[model samples]
Target: MGISPLNCGWGICVFLSLCLISFTPPCDGGNILVYPVDGSHWINMKVLIEELHARGHNITVIRASTSLYIKEKSPLYKSITIELDKKVEPFFIQYLQKHIKAQVEGASAFTFFKITLGFVSAFSQLHLLMCDYLAQTLDDPTMVKSLRDSQFDLVLTDPAIAPGVILAKYLELPLVFNVRWITGGEGHFAIAPSPLSYIPVPRSGLTDKMNFIERVRNVFFYSIALLQQRLIGPHYDAICEKYIEGGCDIISLLQEADIWLFRSDFVFDFPRPTMPNIVYIGGFQCKPAQPLPVELEDFVQGAGEHGVIIMTLGTLVYDLPKEVSDAIASVFAKMPQKVIWRYKGKRPSTLGNNTLLVDWMPQKDLLGHPLTKVFVAHGGTNGVQEAIYYGVPVLGIPLFFDQYDNLLRLQQRGAGKILHLSEISQCFEQSLMEVLHQDSYRQNMQRLSDLHRDQPVAPMDQAVFWVEYVMRHKGAAHLRTEAYKMPWYSYYCLDVVLLLLAAVTLLLLSTVTMFRFLCYRCLRKPKAKQH
Candidate 1:
């Protein structure tokens, strides 16, 4: 009676509970700072941020006012907006508008140097604004104090913004890159093994499969891109020095990054050698198809059998030349399926009864809908990824930047067809019809979608896991490749090649000398016998 059965059971339960609690891992909540380059980059970071915050990480985003639009406000994160010079935003926008118009007219017509220089000029101007912002942030005592107090564990940055790289160096934090494009320019290639023979230069419009001449052209374009980066380097260096104490260069900062999350997947991209630190978190931004707004739901549902076609040029391309719009409308009018076109500019007068124009549309939701037959897009990376995610075949009218390369990959995958802006008026109808009617395009798209979803963990979860893993381990130095530290000649084993060449030459010369000596000895012995 001294020890009761009930007391013994309670004691056993308490012991088990204590043991479980002792074995459980502690939550490693970290302060993460995100430095996004532009609105597109911010959009791409949304899902990753959401997941990290959900897992109890504190996120702080530093963005320009012009580019700071967070659709979902969360208590788990804070946003710091920096106001730029009034003239800066307008100039950047105007320059981009002009460039887009020129591209629409004919990007292929422009010389390679001209295009490369144009991009350099645009990036340089943008970087100058970023530098000004960084200088202001550093000069402001309150801002500097706050950043220091936060004590961020890691910095997530976009390499496109040189100042962001400088800021990471200033904070002395481990850097992790979030590249929104297929390739992250020279900074990415510096860390990863990017063979020019296979990996096409960004914006070069060359595919991975290149012939001898194409390979030479690819190399030439890549050289120009590298030259463009070098030309812009000194300016970036100057900006860094003006802002931070003992400022470091962009290349050095990038090379020191712990990890790089590329928004490109091998399913959509060609196979290439990647280091352990180079993580492919493509489609991480894509969420499940949410319910469309009532009106959109009704419209898509109304297209019962024929289905609907969604056309969007993404957020940047707000203004399309009248001719291009008219040609698109004309093609949509001819098609039997209903069309929903997202046009921010003037409503096209040629819009038919079967078409509806809106200033914005839920592109991902629309693409995921079963009744959506085909997507006519500008081949932006996000749009391509969405189309691939939803298994929607695309008819890409690539205009500029990485659009051409994205479309080229789509075409190679047989999930899409490409129509140049110049050819849109003539080929748009046929391309649209082919993508809609052809069974192969849909089949291939479905296969791609399957491959994209075939991973063990969801893309967003994988991203969050790796991020927390970095924080847990302090830094992922083991994952980083030694290639980044090696010189070009050393990385490629050129020294070994030279040594082999020297050995072969010495052997050849020794053999020739020995043969001549043998001949002379034989002749001299015959002369001696005659004497």
Candidate 2:
């Protein structure tokens, strides 16, 4: 009589339930599809992908054959490479090379537009080629069937490229954007509120706090960007229609994105309005510096108390003009500090005894080294972020794109100085001396570094958490604002303005008619009496 059959059955049921709960694995992270704009973007996103993989998410990367530099051989992730038209790759490279040369030579204002239009034309050609290839792939019954079978959870892509949005629409998956630059263009503003009065346009070379003239200039730049977007946007829409069942606009798709992971932090960027869906995960790709190669380590150590200076112009800028190279070498020759320059071009005839020129260098590692004194760079966003991360002062020689704006921000922070290529021959030594001899530059950079590092969770961890959050919640719809769904006129309240103006006009017209009738009545009585 110790236990009845019913009691035993109840106990057995409870035991089995507890066992089931205990053995059940944590929610498996969802399948993620990553489509980066280029090799550089892939490099920036590599850390985030690896973190997601570690968390048990299935990751698939779709890259163009021309951009397969980061070969993912990991068992955790898979990669699919698509080939572009034969002519596209070579033509793109040639166009970029020509533009870089013109930029370095300080192309005239008229030539600048000519160069810009040429680049845009080349980009459009390549874009059309990619679109055609994608259309062909998606049109194939087998390929479409295979993709539908995969049942992807979400698409993480660079929205800077229009094709990414098209791919997302074709797959019928939630989209999450990964923007490598701080200033996302007009499409970003449409999704999030960025007041033009305060927030400077990207590449405008203006700061957050602006004068009247600066504000006007910002608006002008924004208007130009809008015009350009309008002109080129229709082509993208047409291309997207060919692949996806229901044609979608790139901007509309972007507005519906689950979240935006921006490669920027407030510590380095000016404070601006942001929507709930925008997440700043800057410096997630950065890691503690690895040990340098023995030869490089020896050279760095050999400088002794004099220290070393690191110089690089980023991956795209392979070389400098001979005269520019000569001028830079001449300045380095007089310095006591050792210089390690990354140069892929011809050896400078005036190469200094204290300078060691190499075709490639581990830039982040060099910046993190204790012996490194200052960074002389092209002011690319990645390089500037690395410099700030390591608390190294910069002497930036920005050429084009957002480089000028990046340097401008750095200079504003008192952590760096801008050295324009046009004035480099004359100001190279002076700017170099200022960054090296001035204590303020180093001190300011160190403070920013501290702020950047003093977070509850690491940037990489934060990024991984948010990415998984969106997946678990299925697009994070709660984070999206109603602004995305609103039309331009409605958001700006143009209709309200029109209503108020109409009311005022009607009132004024009625009062004027009444005044005229009173005047005629009074004057007509006097005229009748005289007659």
Candidate 3:
């Protein structure tokens, strides 16, 4: 009679909560060290770091003092900032401009060679700079001691600039890479078996299925990567010799990683041979749309049934050339759809009432908005993945460095259209209008979204599970292949091929000798009988 109904309900709820808590497995977290490449790659690394930190692990980021995007102060991770002699930030803009100019002028064979040589020279120099920074980091006694004393469970790194790979080896820690591009082109080329017959080389601008000319082009570009690697390898080899005990190369170190949380999956990337340790975590950063800011929400809603288009060229190239911008602005002016362009360029004289230019954007939130119909992007991995996540069709304007290739995959899937800078002035209106009116673009993208979403585990959750798996297991040596330790000649079985060829040659020679000896004896016998 004294027990109240409210107290009975509260007691029941408490019992259920206690049961649920008891059944949930606890996260046995460990200390994790992160080595991130700044800019867009950092964005990827940061997402993984956020998840790892949320799971009750400690994170330490090794950053360069000259880092563009990475901050020295952050609540998420303790940073060990390394000193650099000079910042290459200003040089990047110059490089971008020159790269654009080179692509435009690449109509001639002379400029093609010039471009290839220029690229090799520029990248090799940049590789040298990264090596120099690694040398500095290693040379610092206090830095090395701090890293060793930390006794981290693993080193999480973006291997685009692979100081982290070396550091992981030096510290004798378990290695995990948040990777798409390693030191040598695409990550697959570093560890997986990439057959040039079908798998197009990065920057070759070809797809999986290629004709004769395209195959030649793939070989040519792959040759370029090989040459560049040859130039880059010596630098890393020297670092391995100096810093790493027992001496290991960058490629070997990469192959030895405990896990590769690759930011690509079969949904986006072509089907290719992959190893067990490679975990596909595409679209891990994508989530349901958060409510936009009041003004931006009003702008999106203003489009009504016509819907809206979102365009961004990422952080590096916010401003296009004046001519290109004018052409784009003029085209946007003609569209019935409202446009939110993330541009920092001079206001185009042709910019219309339907268009709004902002310096920054909540890109993920905007893409996830229901009214977002078209995404005009530079075909970044993140942007493309987000577009796929939100089921938004794309109108791609690829600037440089895998951007075209990224869009090409979407285009091949019938979900996007690519507008090269060279074509923007003449055909921007045509390309934009085609993508705007095309129903298939939206339909195909939605299909991809469905497939990507129809996974057993969300990509982010899968990625976090793998990270924890490494920590719990100490390292994932069982998943790793022993092919890395084999000599190139043996790995490809060139030795077997040579031995087989040698045996065939010997058999033929013996047969020929026996035939000649029989003929000689028969002729001698005939001559003796005649005598």
Candidate 4:
């Protein structure tokens, strides 16, 4: 029998609908407002921004007028510029150079104090400057009204500074963090339970396994971190009080973030307690190596069986002290491996024929090259992570900040060696040789690489998924804990402990009193009968 016309039309409609639904994505474009820290931090943030752009999210970046790495114009995102007095990054870079020089000279008590004081003062001022910028931005009705009217779906930021956190709260937007450091300390401490017994503090230069002495040292390191929180947080507190609805501390604001795309994984980071909301996106910036430029590829090919070694101190450090540079050059001279050193300083007199000095090189490409043997580095997170991604053993010359601590983790894992600045001249060549010849170094690193790559989803894809999840759900409040809202005593269960202790004490005292009364009654009756 022939099908009815009405039934055939209904069947066609159903088929087309299913096809459309199958083709559509689960999540669509979202309007994202990003507040990012400049310089090296921007490098990582830009990668995420680009990925989001490709995924069809509309991104608006709020940047300072004097921002270093963040340009006013970008194809990836629109810019909401905030005015500032002077450039902060250059000042920070200058301070780091001075600090590196101080470190290389020696670690006397006076030098330590001077360096610490200088660094703390610089960072404190930077935070205060951001607070001022935030104030200026909020105080302007035009800016505030524009922000509110934009109707951004979410606020993405690096919580290393507080303006972004406060702004996100003010706008009543779901917040997400691309974070490693918050002003108070490492991002993990800002939310997670970090027991100093096993979780070593960042820049602490200590390992996860600690002896009694090391535990004491960890406590001392934690004290410094607390001191930093105390020193740096007040400027932000005032801003929060003025702007946020009920007022909040910097840590509280950080904790409210719906998602944290953390930069380090177990490969580079020690295993520690982590929160459900924080997703590890370690090596998200890493990918298969691209083709090297003709010159670099030729140099690598020339190395033959001897292989190549590449060194870069990241963007922050360019010029080492003359003597230190000379010492490094002398050490590289005797090595059979070809060296590609990214040095912006004047040529060292002891420079070797095998070493190729350039203003910059494709670090990822070189590290991924089959001929590259060892990475000589200053232990920056970016380089360290890339080293893990490529399974290259590192011979580190740690200069400042978290450099030594980063290299120290690799040392503990048997993947790298740290040659301190003081010991560099005497031991640099030998350390390089050890890492070059040691099969164990490469093996351990390759093992880490395998584990890091064994994830069910790539780190970048995971990061994108969570970001889209936040956008799709409005916010992941179900996943977020109420612990941040509780007082310290309540959060730690100290109050409950105290209450239990008091109840137990009361019960014990009552029992003792009752026993005494019964004894007294028995003894009194016996005495009366005897009389």
Candidate 5:
């Protein structure tokens, strides 16, 4: 059945025409641009992008750093990495401006030195780096103009990175934010627990009073949050030489967003508020199981005899203390179950043969294994999600920040046990035994896993829908609200009521003091006259 040259040419033309018809333009793919907070943050996002691509959608990624995408080994290597002048450079210029302004004859060296040096020390802190970088990025004119020219219909960002919110507004686009961590406010999502529950809210079931030390630490944390909003944000604007842009305010942006997809589960027990836009797609980032590596196959296969416990503290918090590692080793020494700890950093000498210590392991794959019974991990959102997806019980040893929150949520759900950092030294063996032996934890995990698996639509499908929906609706502006634009005083009711109460209380105190003073004077005069 040899075809003529003319027939072959016609067949080629037909194939080309079909592909063109099926291919959607980049702009028509609902032109969704996703700007994750960091490269690592994109792991969950990749699952959603794959789903969207399957649906014949086009996506563009704008990354904060190249390192994030490089590590993922994604096929989509054609990504745009955003570069900015060093974050510290702006602070340097601002300090110079202040130093120059204060260089007058009246300006004392003490004042100048104190002001300049104080900021220098503060700037040295590593926590300020991301915020500073975001502030500077917003200040660039060409970058801002480029975003405007792109005309992306929807902007997906993590709230941790403020620039995404600002850029969304600059382009007059609707936003969909992945609330990766908890912050205060309605419809806020956290892979971790909310600090608000620690406050005395009735029925919250948290009754323990904070110690002086705990209170001080909390105060410091809150102060940093305030400083970011008040100082760093405006400082960013000053450096950018532009007023803040985006959907007007945080509330407005949130309201205007087509969807607010949280990477949380119903079992995690996040504070649920009644909002149309808010959707619980927590385990959406997790997809169906993939196969494990060939080298690890034997260990996983041998798991059913005594069962298996997978221990991993997640990638972000590696290099645990020597004491903690020793405690873990002690537990592994006793356990009959084949323990596979994803031990990062140099392996300590105390490790046992029953344990498999590897630099990294396919976490989701391990959880999915039928022989796997429990997960021993540092409570992270990613870890929690994986555990839920596979119905694996957990022993969560939270180190700091949202790890505490994430661990607490698992505890409340009865899906896991919360091991204090201190317990890692003394009670490590006992805690591991309890976690492994407990039937309730395992059952709870299975229950949650079922709920997560039974969602009406997969997280990827939901994310893809909202993304394209924004483009279809030309930026879901109808969903936006006026609450974000209200003045702070109005929002908190601090302006009028608090001021009136203060004024009235001071006036009454003054009157009482004056009356007492007059009475005392009269009594003294009478006593003196009699004498």
Candidate 6:
């Protein structure tokens, strides 16, 4: 039964067509997975998710809370817990492990630390998960496996969660890390000051002895860390080898990424590394105005020419001490212009006629209004970006975390002033007066604001363009750096052992030459005596 040549060729073509159909990803509904660090919906994830959904992508949101859903109801919200175990689907584990192995060897030391810290910060994440009221909706292993098997097109993630990132890698999905603040750049600490110029020298400059003590303290602490790493390093090494080949190569992930969207203005000193993948998409989410709420509009209009000042301490740090509140109230009472505060807790008893305290306010909308003069803030990145967007100068009362760093940049840029927690009374009042009365701060802020707004494309659009570029290019390996593959010593060019050997050889030769010259001179003296 000999098959005819023409019939065989046609059969092969039909077989290949079916194979292509089976392998191709479904275009009818592309999944866009959102992986927020627990309860981090407020950290620009909400807006991004909404935007992605609006663009007609089928979204499967893997978040850590119901608090996010409480304010905004959407069909896309998938209440899945992020905890991964053997109970998870076998296929997902296989995909994730395989995917991570390919990328792990090229990760940077910094990336390694960030991914490890994600594991260490589990307590913090759990706390947020509990606080945000999302403990019950965790995704079971099977569901996660099923989703991975389905093969999503893109993963929008926060790098603080290594597991989510690893999952993205396993699924071969295009990923984007949402860096909420300007924490990666030098001097721009997430929760503290950088160890660069600002060595923990006290502000008074009277503690020379303390600096020595601090140095010794740091050495001892680092020694302890080394000792611990030595003890557990082998175990971790073994585990990583067993699971993710080459373990945690975070640097490779950073370099291989399509683009890094920094939500920071140029005023933020983003330690400019020579990398093309980094993009300053500083105020992507900040949109220009819609008219203010009717009551708020009338209130601003009624203020006549004195205008308005807005005071807010963002979401997490809203719990200001009563004394601090009293001090702020006292200062605001003295100002001629009207003040509107988004004080979340109890309203103060001593409210003046010109002041209004509300549980919440449309912060960006208020800042965008023409009558708003100054901002008193906790110096959160979003607030800082908004203030910069609106060209309104700030009086930063930085309490804790990266607030201090953000405040410092604003002060250095001449766009704002910083008032420490202890010196808030004198500093805050004085700074507020200067910002309002003097025109330089406002003018400088406006100049910077204009530069930020004048960019070629809006930040969010640029972000979307890059995301699509990654998918189109099938991971964009052209953007990845070769530097990531080099060993630490090779990268630093430390051939010190070879240099030491060369120095020893030269010293020995020089000594032998000197000895020979002296002997010859002595022998010549003897010959002269004999003559």
Query: Once model 3 is optimally superposed onto the true structure by TM-score, how far is the C-alpha of residue 238 displaced, in angstroms?
Result: 1.2
TM-score of 5: 0.71
What lDDT does each candidate get?
0.79, 0.79, 0.88, 0.89, 0.64, 0.61
lDDT of 3: 0.88
Task: For model 4, give the RMSD to the true fold.
Answer: 4.2
Write the residue-wise lDDT of candidate 3 on 40-139 in tens digits: 9988889888888887899999888988899999988999888886776665677777767755444566865675677677777887898898898888
Residue range 1-531, candidate 4, lDDT tens digits? 999999999999999999997552478789999999998889999999999999899999999898878999999999999888788868778777777777677668688778787788878988998899999999999999999999999999999887899999999999999989899778888788899999998777898999999999899888998998898999999998888778888888888899999999987888899889999999999999999999788888888999999988888777788888999999889888889999998899899999999988889988999999999998988889999999999988887777888899899999999887878778888888899999999999998888888998899998998999999899998878888888889998999999999999999999999999999988885434553
Predictions ranked by lDDT, top down?
A: 4, 3, 2, 1, 5, 6
Model 4 steric clash pairs: none
- lDDT of model number 5: 0.64
Determine the C-alpha RMSD for candidate 6 after optimal superposition of all C-alphas: 14.0
Model 1 segments more than 4 A misplaced: 1-26, 68-76, 86-92, 103-116, 180-188, 239-248, 499-531
How far residue 471's Cα lies from its native spot in candidate 2, in Å, is: 1.1
For candidate 2, the 10 contiguous residues with the lowest summed lDDT are 180-189
Candidate 2 Cα outliers beyond 4 Å, as residue runs: 1-27, 72-76, 87-96, 180-187, 507-531
Q: Residue-wise lDDT of candidate 6 within 1-531, one digit each (tens)?
A: 999999999999999999987552423334677666533224576676666666666767664323323233367555454433222123223333332332224455475455434432433333233322321222345665677675777777765433444456546677666664311222122222224222322111111133665666544443533343343334323323434545653334443445555566565543433346655677777898779889988888877788999999766544455656777888888877889998876666556778888888889899998999999998877888888888999988764345766777678778898876667645667878998878889998897788778986788877766665665565665664576567757755666766888999999999999999998988885434553
Candidate 3 Cα errors over 4 Å, as ranges = 1-26, 102-109, 112-116, 511-531
Number of the top TM-score candidate: 4
lDDT of 5 by residue, 367-421 (tens): 8888888898878778888888889888887643356667676787888888766
- In the order shown, the candidates' Cα RMSDs to the true structure are 4.8, 6.4, 4.2, 4.2, 13.4, 14.0
Q: What is the lDDT of residue 151 in candidate 6?
A: 70
Q: Which candidate order results from sorting by TM-score in descending order? A: 4, 3, 2, 1, 6, 5
